[model samples]
Target chain A: MKASDGQLIGYEKEGSELWLWDDLPELHMEAGYRIDRLLHYERSPYQEISVAETAAFGRMLVLDGVPQVTEKDGYIYNEMITHLAMVTHPHPRHVAMIGGGDCGPAREAAKYTEVERIDVVEIDARVSEVCRLWLNRDPSERADSLTHLHHADGAKWIRKPPVPIDVLLIDRSDPYGPSAALYTKAFYKSVYDSLSADGITVFQSGSPFFDMKGLRITTQRLRSLFPVVRTYWTAIPSFPGGMWSFTLASKGTDPLLGCMDRLPTDTRYVNKAIIPAAFELPNFIQSALD
Target chain B: MKASDGQLIGYEKEGSELWLWDDLPELHMEAGYRIDRLLHYERSPYQEISVAETAAFGRMLVLDGVPQVTEKDGYIYNEMITHLAMVTHPHPRHVAMIGGGDCGPAREAAKYTEVERIDVVEIDARVSEVCRLWLNRDPSERADSLTHLHHADGAKWIRKPPVPIDVLLIDRSDPYGPSAALYTKAFYKSVYDSLSADGITVFQSGSPFFDMKGLRITTQRLRSLFPVVRTYWTAIPSFPGGMWSFTLASKGTDPLLGCMDRLPTDTRYVNKAIIPAAFELPNFIQSALD
Candidate 1:
């Protein structure tokens, strides 16, 4: 597919056969690794990567084509999404994750043995099947923690949550296609209603740099619905904008308040010292909200 | 350049020419703009961007490009790098960003007017010169906050910092080469010494995902030096690994503490509701420390 003009900017080849579009800009890769849809393309830091995978989840993103939840950098998203709410609740016995088919967040949630039952609400059943086949090769891992996997619309599912859930995670896709509706204030209000009084909800807001507008909109929407609503950003290199943001809202204690004292041991990232530091915001973001 | 036999693979480009090389396969984008170096390049994101200023600062590092700061998505990096430290320190008298010559962080940092002063400590004066001329045009908008511009070494300068700095942002290049010295425990200690008793420090650590080994080493190093040290990750589309991490340390209260109570009414991205949410860590990160 060519960009702008009728530029044939995409191509494919099989073994010795090569096919090139007339207008597709020259790709930096070799003649191998079949070119699929470009998830996100841009300049800066040697060109970022956040494209979908034709092989998995129908079209799951392949940011840099490397695994975001590998043994290396997985902690940032996995821990914050799961633990922030999991530990915040006075007693989070039964938990559920909405649209976390990757198992990255689910894998992180399972660490809390206190979470006796974990449910994953995924839109695409294929993603879970693929993850079970490829991503999570060990059945002993998330398999033990995951009590149920429901193939259903996350938004619709949360509106009338079946069972009593203490913590709910909205680890869905970007706020664009199927995931766009999830960003609305109504969906979050439903999420708030679905949770127990002491429950907490966390979800990945878009990048603040490029999606500051989206971040603000979502944060505001969530704020109107939840009593305790907050927005924080993190940095992951595989997204378009170098900076990323997340929103956490709870009807319980401030996640930041007394968090340092209660921090768990064996953490590679969060600690007592850095607890208060994560809440700080840079100028641009501060200006955006103010 | 060309890849050696069995060395691994990494690639980047300039103009119409594409280059490839071999290494361990680590791609890190530091300070949101420059590619520090290519550790490995077997498979890379070179074909992602329109080539032009490939070797602007240094070589288009095809591999081991130093995993500088990873966010789950880009929002956290922008938000944390901007808000986490900026909001905590009450009325940052002056702010100096070292190595963030690209202006993305600087632009983000400028949102705080309490930061009466901002100085960008850049090593390659050429980088700033070019960015000002090409990339970041509104120098008057944000760069004007920069009270000073120093081409000297950020490490050396931090040892004897200027202006009772309330916040010293080490937004430097990757943790290698000239910047490599910046990531040392000793360097962070200097940063610790440079800030006011209540001052805070936030800088990109590295990709805790792919650089878990590096994150462990750096976290261990930084933790020992500072009374409070925490590592958090964000995601960026440009980086190889999706999950990126940052370390925030402070001499006063925990960095994640506080709300946007003092924020000017004009601010856009930060507020009380969003404050505590930033401290939330994904589960994988929590497990890493374990």
Candidate 2:
């Protein structure tokens, strides 16, 4: 029996869905999605990347055994990760995205009327090609206007001038691999130097439950460089902690002071209500970040 | 290979971790916890009752095969479900609790210095005793000061009077079988008539993702009776939806106008930051309730 056959809905075989991350043995944890099939799997020069067409979440891009983005919930991540900082900075024109290989952040930033240029610096060009060819669907139905794909090391590349970015979106992978440099204070200083005087940078902070040290260290690193720093979260069921934290580091403008009563572009999730609301942390998580 | 040999942790065999609900098989989903052991299993006059001691979640009370409460994250649900309404009311003295046989709501309500008494009306007495003898560890360290458990049907019992309750916590099971009447429009009217002039009531609304129909009906029912009704959500990773919703209905005062700066007692999760944040729903969910 299968769900497609409409035979009372719950008759699919267990082995039909086979994407589970059994990597985190310490917490006795694993999480993955129910996909239609594995679409593309290959080793890029940087990392192992796999794309899938999920049954519930549409297309998904998995890198190194963890899900980077899924079509269904990508808007929640991409919109909040981009718009939270973009809207906070008074006039964010030239936005820089570090390690957004999937082009999700690029597509979102391009939606904003205020954003003139978006430089998405992904280490692996193959991830962007895979997404462009397979996973990139017009989720919000916005015209992909101005997102320049740059294949280079983001840590060193952002040091050079590129229009003095007003807002930077760090959509990097976790802090354990080649992406580790992006989490350092020096890297944050480099990002600070690349931004305008009133610039803001947003990035996905690690889950506090499973990656408390990473979250603590990341927040500390950002706080040392930026004047105003805060942590917010979003929920995607297939993730390890179910709650994913995002940090906004600004020079003077605070994202919590997000009062752009109306967005310049359309979004599925991010709104004025969600801006300050997202910063509310659970007590345990608040303690972990402390 | 085990976590229990003179160790601070407890470990059990992989076989001990079972009972994934294959009932909702169409989504190809299941969720279960690693158990220390199945402590109790039997059928009450109403429905099935089973208890288990879990590795990650401490003791779990699963009624009719759905988890009622888990020790690890029970306080998160217990506190949010109780305090959100309790704090909103001007002076919550006499409170009412329905269907919380695990005494989670009663325990949390007893923490309030302003709450002199709480009348807990539950149909099943056996469920209360089972938890009292086994699972009620007082995670919040509040003395069992003023929660009186009444063994009576809540739907009919709440229709009667108990000094005109100030705050009501309806911690019923899912909106099905025995617990279905509590979600009806008429039952909501009964609750409305039972409350004080400035009273507020709160209940666990169904998940918008899996049980949208129930969420819709619950919100509709609450809206028809109360002047103000709002839906808020919390995340308990082990639950069915990973996200759970609660509805707060007030006679004239709005729960959304919550501005209680502090609490009278200690808590691990709920704080002033979480109140307004919890009420901020995602766009799709806000549309569902609309």
- The reply for model 1, stretches above 4 Å from the true place, is A1-72, A137-146, A176-181, A184-186, A258-276, B1-290
Candidate 2 DockQ score?
Answer: 0.43
Model 2 residue B69 distance off true place after TM-score fit, in angstroms = 2.4
**lDDT by residue (tens digit), candidate 1, A193-229:** 8888778888788767556788888778877777887
Question: Candidate 1, after superposition: displacement of residue A69 in Å?
Answer: 5.5
What residue runs in model 2 are displaced by over 4 Å at the alpha carbon?
Answer: A1-24, A43-48, A139-143, A161-163, A184-186, A258-262, B1-26, B36-55, B139-143, B161-163, B258-262
- Best of the candidates, TM-score: 2
The lDDT values for all models are 0.57, 0.74
For each candidate, report its DockQ versus the true two-chain complex: 0.15, 0.43
TM-score, candidate number 1: 0.55
| Best model per lDDT | 2
Best by DockQ: 2
Q: Taking the tens digit of each residue's C-alpha lDDT, what string does model 2 give over A164-214?
A: 989998887777676988877778889889989898888788666557777
